[model samples]
Target: MDKQRENLTAADKKSEEIIEDKRAVQIADPSKNSVAGKDTELAASQVGYQDLFDNMPNGCVYYKVLLDEAEDPVDLVYIKVNSAYGRNIGRSLSELIGKRVTAVFQELTGEGFPCMETYLNVALLGEPVNFTQYFDQQDKWYSISAYSPQPGYVVEISEDITEQTKAEGERRERERQVALIERVASLGALAAGVAHEINQPLQALKIMADSMIYWYDKGKETSVEKVIESCRKISVQAGYITSIVEWMQDSVNKAWSDAPEEVDVKKMIQRVLILVQERLRAHGIQLRENSCDNSLMVWGDSRRLEEIVIIILVNAIDSFVCVDQGAREIRITTSCVEERAVIEISNNGPAIPDDIIGKIFEPFFSSSKSGTKLGMGLAIVKSVVNAHNGTIQVFSSNQQVTFRIEFPQYRQSV
Candidate 1:
């Protein structure tokens, strides 16, 4: 209400100025009666235009859009807006009428109005705004529009956009929470499997390094082959631990990591499979592969990809371990399609329950009787897949369950 009162006061002052100017011109041109009449007509015309603007019901953001030399692009500054726009921004029309709309609303949007910026972007391209934005501070929303009234004049209208965005934010949060819960649960159930996975590689590395150390101490290490072999074993062991830690870490944060490096999919898969090979052998799960990328070069951190594959494999292995299932088997095959590299991990266990299939990636949502999992393995798998700009889908039938992942080829220069 205070803002509106200020606008009224300013409008009155402007009208008085127009009247005084007209009177001055009339007195000066009295010797030429026709010229004095023309001045009177012009003043009367401006009065109606100003009156219409002052009486409008809501906020108005009519602005003169400035364009570039090509006239196809709009500049983000120096645009003309109106009195109502000033009120919406808690400023006076007199101070805001000739300023750019972007400058005024930039602070209103929390992060600056992406919607308005987008609107202006389109408007500058000789298009118009037909959207609404909800302003939290003013407890209202706005419907906005823009047009090129003249060569550089962009007239805009903004009506109040509040209800819809709030609903959207609420909806997204609900989905995020649910997903986090299910994934954590899956991770919990797979705890035993993951431990065994890391331990196997460590065990091998320990054995190989120990043997190398014993030979060296006995002074029977006559050949350089012994030292080289021991160093190789220790290297392999450290490599395995590093890989697992990297993958798990990447899933939990959004930090900016360096660009994706070359991934030797075949060798890494074999090494990862080695980590879990004991579990696979114990469960009688068979493994097969065809590295069609020849290099199977994926465009992401190797360890991160390993985590994704490991999680899926662990979940499948867990499903079969349940007492209700009889035929236990999981197989992974790799392939390359155009710019994409794919890995398909399939298993034959009891068919997943219809009720639980879709919600599998949701956090704390578990079918594990072990009570260890909070159900996060598949959820992490999904996150890793998404981060890579890849896709993951599951298919199930009476006899088989298949999880397919497609990734952009690292060699393809994405």
Candidate 2:
């Protein structure tokens, strides 16, 4: 019995040795141990990537391209989405994943969502695109960037920009309000010139009416032709007066509201000159309109353009306060240069000091010696020009100060 126990123990030892040899082989072969380690590391790496995707602040989505019978992408299938994506769309992952985009947002079907075309291009072409979209259903704006990560798969990252868009809109509205205020101020400054322009016609009308009244009251003989001519003159004067009042009213009412249109530069300049002519004469300043092209045209609000001309003209007029009236001259020229309409208004007044020229367009910066002006005129002028996609420059030399303005020439589309 003892011999039998010893043999059994030896057999058990041999079996244990065989198991240890197998374990040693497994450790010595990289294919077994290293492969297991590699698989564990790969699983950990995938988990880490998933964690990062879920934690991203911006909404992230992975989409699989859905193709029509023609092999053109028609819609997208949500393959995967991060937590922020669910928060952005107000949907859970269970509701979004494996769902078609059209089914998720039914209103986006057909041509309603133009962004689908951009997405399709990105997915099929493996390109990247960025765009901003406003969703009426959500009442929000999103700035989205999308790129294809692989064939038939695209990744999109989106940020909510609704607040930013609203802020920008509010900023624009405030600017418009400020511009309106400046326009009113400009009109106030030109009130005297406008009144003078209206008065000339009023005086002519008075004379014509008085002549007709005197002929009838004094028993003076007059031909029917003479009476008819007097009536015609009276009508003409009345029309002129009406024109002036209407022009002023239009300027005040549509300073900031009117849509851009083709404006005749020469006709506009001529009309402005009519209003300021009396003032120029009063100051003994010679107004010279040189090289004004009748066909010169620009695209802008005529009232605002008129305001620009008037402001610069007023500034030029004020520059002559200390200047010798006999030597004062204001020259206006309009021409086309390099597909641009150029207006040059120069005055032979005191030159703008070198230190002040740069700040002329700044709000509340005035070069006037009297210091009574609000100094918003040139600032408003700069704003108006910029709003119209135009430019204005000033140069002064040899007792001559010139305001050079350029606007893109209006081209009628064929």
Candidate 3:
């Protein structure tokens, strides 16, 4: 019994000695057991975080806010940006890190753009901002989400929406074209003028034929010179009819081509005026022009540009006829500004209400209650201007309105 107790004590001592030896080893090299392993674990965690960041579907940009003397966020430096963010900015990821936001996108820092202010708000106030914005220069749409993860730091996530926006625009354009055709079909006033114009040329041709028949009936000696002259007159009148018919056919067909060429601005305007002048006169609307040099040119489709002018003129004429209160007058002026050609069409008619002015260029937007109204004319005009890399704006006040269109002047490549 005493020998068994002694053996149990020795076993207990052996277990204690083993534990003590392990404790000593840990004390001698603590890093191998805890600190070193912890470092390895931390490194693996960092690599995971980096991998997650790099593979994120949406564009991600991390910014460190630079503050003013008042501790207000004045600017932001790109601390880190993912590959998607670099592509969205049309730059390399290596080129963007450490760059300032102002240096990266100068337009955003300007007064008209709200991106800089929105970012600053998130950074300084720790507020989250989520919105969709169209970047005109980039010609893209982005669904942006920004939030401050820490003081003076902001993270922005962006998803590209360009394809979605383009799809919507294409759908709207198709609807607008259909509505335009329906509206034109309903315009009896314009239809009557077109018919009258077509008939005049036909009537003249008939009169010349009748004169030839009379000469033959009386057996009068027809000189070859006179016959040739009569034939020439008939040809001219027939050509006029053909031109008017072709114009109507093309307008109704709505065939648009992407091929662009050097277009004489003055000649295009004259062609449009020829189409609309009679209609304007029938409506008692006087047209006046403060001419610019005919030498000014633009790079675009002449037919499309003429269509834009026609839409604006028709809209103006309709307003004049609708209001029927003031002197129905449209004044046109053209000039060159820097590298752009500017055309201004002003009318002394009913002023467009301030509330709806911004909506005028939107598809299917119209304030007029006329049955013939399509509300797509100005929208088409805006689309055409954008296609030509041009800009259009409206100013209205005191029963007067002006549409100003500016196009990049076409210069021949040397």
Q: Estimate the TM-score of every prediction.
A: 0.51, 0.71, 0.46
Mind sharing the TM-score for model 2?
A: 0.71
Candidate 1 vs candidate 2, lDDT winner: 2
Q: Which candidate is the best by TM-score?
A: 2
User: Tens digit of lDDT per residue, candidate 1, span 118-194?
Assistant: 64565557666577666666777778776655554456677654556668778877866754554454345446677
lDDT of 3: 0.80
Candidate 3 lDDT tens digits, 170-249: 99888677646543543332354457666766778899999999999999989999999999998987776777678877
Off by over 4 Å in 2: 1-48, 67-74, 106-128, 148-151, 258-264, 274-286, 292-299, 314-329, 335-342, 347-379, 382-414
Query: Which rank order by TM-score, best down to worst?
Result: 2, 1, 3
Cα miss at 247, model 1 (Å)? 2.5
What C-alpha lDDT values do all the predictions have? Answer: 0.69, 0.85, 0.80
lDDT of 2 by residue, 1-414 (tens): 999999999999999999998789887885887888899999999999999999989899999999999998899999999998898778999999998887777633333445778898998888798889887777789999999988999899999999999999999899888767877877775675577667767777788888888888999989999989988888977776776788888987797684778998888888888666656777788998787434888888988898789889877887788888888999998888998989999999888889988999998788666776677788888988998899999999977899999999898899
Clashing residue pairs in candidate 2, if any?
A: none
